[model samples]
Target: MTFLKRGVPLGIAFLMGVLMAFQYYVPHEHSKAFLELMTRWDKIIAGFAVFIGAYSLFHLHYTRIKRRAAGWGYSFFVFVGAFVTIAFGLYNGGEAFWHDKKEGTMFDWIYMNIQVPAGATIFSILAFFMASAAYRTFRARTVESTVLLVAAIIVMLGRVPVGALISQYIPVAADWIMGVPNLAAKRGILLGVSLGAIATSIKIIFGVERQYLGGGD
Candidate 1:
């Protein structure tokens, strides 16, 4: 049982990871063909993943509703929204389920009128939260924090017409700060992230990282 659950998955991960990593560097026709085949398989696997994710979401909400857990009322909306949207999609604006959905379909109407507005409202609410977080972050308690606050102020001001009215140099300084220092910092962070990802991939390929197998053991 241990071998079937752990060993098999680890072995498969290592083999597939190594093969996919090398596929990029190999210039042979066979390598290209193999990459294409794997790409198709990836899409098929992704389709299955979507179903799995839906099942997991449904199961979670179902359990919450069944238990009458805290905020269980919200779970009811999950089922309602999902069912209504799916029904509208399948109904396909009375064109029959087999027909392709076009612009005037019920699915499109729900997506445009209901989902889009809801999404926009949610983002609008998020702007306030982001402002509050930025306020907290921009406190000039330390030298680094002071520098960050200054840079953020310059960028924000330079983006608006008022900054240009004050002085042309404000915009030039803002552009210089963003184009040079900000870009350099961003590249450094990206380099670190890429190296971390490579290290983690190597660890997984060598079976040193088995968290994906589940459980602390």
Candidate 2:
């Protein structure tokens, strides 16, 4: 039981990790073939994972509805939306499953009218939240904060055509700040993330990171 729970998965992970890592350095046909095979396997696994995720979501909503939990009414809408979307998708608007959905199809209509608007509304709300956060954080209390506040104001105004109309140098200075300091900082962040990812991958490959296997299981 212990071997079945741990050894088999660990061994498989180690082998696959080593094989996938070699695909980067080895310029061989076998490596390419293995990579292609693994890519297909990834898609198959992801397809299975989708079912798992959907079941989990539905189970959560079902339990909430059953228990008559607070805000359980909202879960009813979740089920309704999921069913409606799935029904439209499977109906395929009177077309075959393999055929592409037409622009005027029910699925596309739902996506454009319902999904797109909801997503846009959420993002619009986020913009206001961001503005509030910026107002709170961008105080000119210290030298660093003052510099940040000034740069933010310059960037905000310079992006607009009125900034150039008001003063030619405003846009030029904004471009300089963005092109030099902003780019340098972004590169440094990317370097740090890349290093961290590499280290984590190394740890996982060596079985030093067993966190992926649920802890205390």
Candidate 3:
């Protein structure tokens, strides 16, 4: 058991390293199986980690309520919401909103009315700030600045009813700018992100990322 706690992990790490190193060239059924197994294991682990978050949240809220903190009312609300949600969820046989409407009435109301509107309102506020920032950055103070300013103006007009009446090319230019340049940049970023994720996953699988498993001292 001690050997497994030490030697077996090392052996698995070494094997995984070799397999990953040769995976690109070795496009076989075994490689496909390994990838599928890794994917499902990741999803399973991620699903289980939700319980850890829920437990921590519950403990934090309970402690605040017990100490009669300044925001104890908020903590009480949190406790009530989480407990109600859990109760209804269990009533539905531990599945997602599969039961009748009465079973998940409070859960559905809180989610639809409270959570959704707040999320949308926050997003709307952020988008307003983004547009303001864009306007500040895109002001025409120089020749180069004027070029970006012109592009921005054109794109903005193209997004509305006015540009189409002036010329069809305005919208076409906007589409090219958004589709080609934006897509290229986002694609590069996504590829880098995916590689980083894969590297992080490999580190976790090799026990190099013990923090994820609540193993930091």
Candidate 4:
């Protein structure tokens, strides 16, 4: 059981990772073909993984509904929504899944009316949450915090037309702050994260990181 569950997966991971890493440096035709083959395999595996994830989600909600757990009513709505969408999508007005749904169909109607508005509503709610977070975060306690608070305020104001009416300098300084300091900081963070990810991937490839195998004896 240990050999089948752990050893085989570890060996495959090590080999695949090393092969993919070397493929970057060795730009031969064979290497390119290998990469293309792996990419196709990845897509196929990803499709199966998606089904697994969807099954897990539905199973969780179904259990909640079956147990009559708290907020089971919401779980009921989840089933309703999923079933309605799937029914409309599969109906497809006699068209196959690969083909686009014709306009005025149930699927198209639900997407434009229900899905789009729900997404927009979620985004609108997120704005209020962001404002609340900014309020808590941008307290002018220390010198660095004071500077951050001021910069955030400037950026917020400068983004709107009212800041121009207040003072031209406010907009100009905000633009300079964003263009210079913000860009430089962003690039530095990106480089740091990229290097860290490369190191972690190398460690995983070498089997120095075993967390992916799950925790057990």
State every prediction's TM-score relative to the real structure.
Answer: 0.88, 0.91, 0.62, 0.89
lDDT of 2 at 69: 97
Question: Model 1: per-residue lDDT, tens digit, 84-116?
Answer: 999988888887689876568878888999999
Q: After superposing candidate 3 on the true structure, give the runs of residues whose Cα lies further than 4 Å from its correct spot.
A: 1-34, 63-72, 93-114, 132-153, 187-217
The ten-residue window of minimal lDDT in model 2 covers 95-104
Residue 113, candidate 1: alpha-carbon lDDT: 95
Better by TM-score, candidate 2 or 1: 2
Could you give the C-alpha RMSD of every candidate to the true structure, in order shown? 2.2, 1.8, 5.1, 2.1
Q: In model 4, which range of ten residues has the least summed lDDT?
A: 93-102
Q: What is the lDDT of residue 75 in candidate 2?
A: 98
lDDT of 3 by residue, 148-200 (tens): 77877877888987898899888898888889876897899999999999898
For candidate 3, list the clashing residue pairs, or say none.
Answer: none
Report, for every candidate in turn, its global Cα lDDT versus the true structure: 0.92, 0.91, 0.77, 0.90
What TM-score quantifies how close candidate 2 is to the native fold? 0.91
**Better model by TM-score: candidate 1 vs candidate 4:** 4
- Candidate 1 pairs with clashing backbones: none
| lDDT, candidate 3, at 14 | 58
118-185 per-residue lDDT for model 4 (tens digits): 99999999989999998877788899999888888899889899999999988998999899999999
- Which structure is stronger by TM-score: 2 or 3? 2
